[model samples]
Target: YRVGKAPVPPRTSVPFDPAIFDATSSTFYSALSNVDFRIGAGNAGAVAVRFRVAQHGYLRHVDFHIGSGLAGVYQAGNEFENLRFFGGRYGIMSEKTSPAWQFTLIDSEFQGQRNAAIREHEVDLTLVNVAIRDTPVGIEIDRGYSDSLWGKDVRFENVSRAGVIVSAENSVFTQIGFDNAVASNTPTFVRFRDSGKTVAGAGPRYRVSDFSYGLKLAGLGTIGDYATDIQMAPLARMPARRTPAIRAMPPVRDWANAHDLGVKGDDTTDDTAALQRAIDTHRVLYLPVGRYRVTDTIKLRPDSVLISLHPSLTHLYLPDETPAYMGVGGPKALLQSAKGGNAVVSGLGLWTGGVNPRATALLWKAGEASMVNDVKIQGGGGTLLTKGSPIGFGDPRARFDGQHPSIWVTDGGGGTFAAIWSPNTLASAGFHVSNTKTPGHVYELSAEHHYRAEIVLDNVENWEFLAPQTEQEVRDGVDAIST
Candidate 1:
């Protein structure tokens, strides 16, 4: 052992190939989930201490050694969901060098952190439905002004220190919910303690109860003279499940062209029967570049993977006709995937041949790791979806004799929707999550231009809507406000 100074150990580098991993296409990959990583026993130079998660990507559904003990992130856009961190020195620490803005965390839990659950600096954060248990400090935010700490359903129980520790780093708090948190000895929401890193920002704005309930409710400790907001109820009210219902890896079957399978992509033929037959028998729907017309609905097989040569090359044209509102599921969607379906529809184009405002472009009922990506849509109802469903246009649920949304989530099996653009859609709500008993997670959501409310939450207790980018609020709709 050295007596004068401690010697630094050598750093090992892990190998990663972008072409092999292909992380840019989120829907094509599933290998990152359900992985477990363990390092040596707790030591200063343990393998876990030297390891760090890749900067600006997803740490989803994997249990790492020290709970993604990430530091020195190179860029932004990193996401974490459904990950559990235990027995780690700290869950995730953003030091002075980390410049990632608005790192999103959803449906994750942290326990047995040696010091704190999170040690943040200079980064704005969005934490939804996250639980922190048995931690000294749940979260220690160093800066306050430019950094906004927005969270919903964030619970803290069996904590040693406060749920969050701050140094007046000047981070602003718009949506703060610590009314349900109990931590350390005092059980405070935000403890104005010293984290040693001071930041300069604005005078932080806060909104707790909107002229309804009084501030400083009983059992909830004081936030500080500068504190004044409360949070929504029931964040961790349910369990988060990440199991894919169809329990099979993305198939590696040989591609089969739809035109070769007795189905023509010509603009006039009613290819509904032929396409449905193809979707039922085949595992992959690799259509060539052409417009395939269909009069009736197409039922997608549970394990089918419908991918196209290119979105511009392949198209599904549904003609406007009499209402085919089948009460069995909801609407006879142009493309329907039933319960427990692990369908994958990607790189295609959908167009309602006529002004058929009665049916959705796609009704994805089975969201168990199912995905619909890179599909351009025009006209018709937008979409009626669960956790992992996508959208096109219009509200198919309106003609079903009930108010329906472009995004409807009823299942609790939790999934994700990314790069979703719903510019033109006729629906009661742009986003709706209801009729579920378990907590769900949907991150990187961007939707707009729908009727009624842009955001709607009813009967659903805890759903993590992380990094939502919503715009184009309608006149009658309340964007981002749950009613």
Candidate 2:
């Protein structure tokens, strides 16, 4: 695989031969993307396609389904993008537990799921730029809410029972919304089964249109618009994704491993010198699952790649009693980004050891050509800081109002700090996006438990934010990432 660049394989549709196509059990962070799997009405299995245990993954441009049983996708949290499932018994039957803790479907299609296009329960659900058609029930929130649900710009066609179903037996939802929905052939847009007391005044910012054959639901009132009120693409049509041409990839053994270089990740030993030695020796680094305690910063080589597939499993921390790297407030991070620029760091967790309020968690000055995605930061004053436009002064040269990218942009000299697809991070502030002159890019921020604002924006413009959710929580008694 190429370093610092994401793999954009050729867009091909192939039959789902479980032996050859399914890589579900290959690796923890394996990406099954860039293809389509069609099941045209043949009896498949109870489950057609699902990555069983992917905590931080992004599955893009892949279609999978079964003719019988549950024929939809079972993914949550920054999982699906540009996906489609048609000619199946059901659309999406997902829960809150496996794969991830949240259900996020962006820019996808669900067709002919005669029963329910989406059967959601437990986790926080996010649906943006989605289309559901030819289904009896479109989006069925049949179960209780373990978290929140936020959606926008969903197109529906030929939906019979309702565009959405919110069960009354479910407990009170903390947050729920489905704004600006466009539908066709859908009667009774949002039907509240049983009583309506659970979601009556829940402040749901949802509306199902098509203006109805006559009227709308009970206590929730007349939902949606005239369906034709907004202009949108036809139902069940997923836009084609443009990507770079496919290239040959080398095997994994060529890269360097920190574990092989005599660095122990027991969290008790100060792995500073050995870690520094590993960094000095290798150009590409891989740290396996384990927590490594460091007392000093380990510098990085130029244009290197550091990967830890499981962020929740691999951690790098600083000891609580370790002396501050420098002066006032300990302005250093445990794992410092390389001044070398053009680095790729993904799938790792970094936390300031102990509950040191003045401790700084992370500092990203890896130049503009660098990227840090799927990395979790916890327990510090400055949880994360992306210092410049692309490691320099703001270059308001272009706007970022472009298509959603599954991976971090490599060629452009812009700073990208993506933390785990759509996972709800608990911090003092959700997003402290500031001091940039870049424009025309879109972001999907799903952060919660902020001391101040879910999104604290300052000195930026022309960017887009989609289906954002914010709440308040404090981690480790220290309010990190305060805007």
Residue 207 in candidate 2 has what lDDT? 37
lDDT of 2 at 318: 62
The residue-level lDDT of candidate 1 at 441 comes to 52
**lDDT of prediction 2:** 0.51
The 0-to-1 C-alpha lDDT of every candidate, in the order given, reads 0.51, 0.51
Candidate 2, residue 354: lDDT: 38
Candidate 2 segments whose C-alpha is farther than 4 A from its true place: 1-45, 48-63, 73-87, 94-102, 106-124, 127-254, 273-283, 298-302, 325-330, 338-342, 355-358, 366-370, 379-431, 439-455, 462-469, 474-483
Per-residue CA lDDT of candidate 1, range 313-376, in tens? Answer: 4677664443453333353456666655556776566654333455555655555466654454
Clashes of each: 18, 16
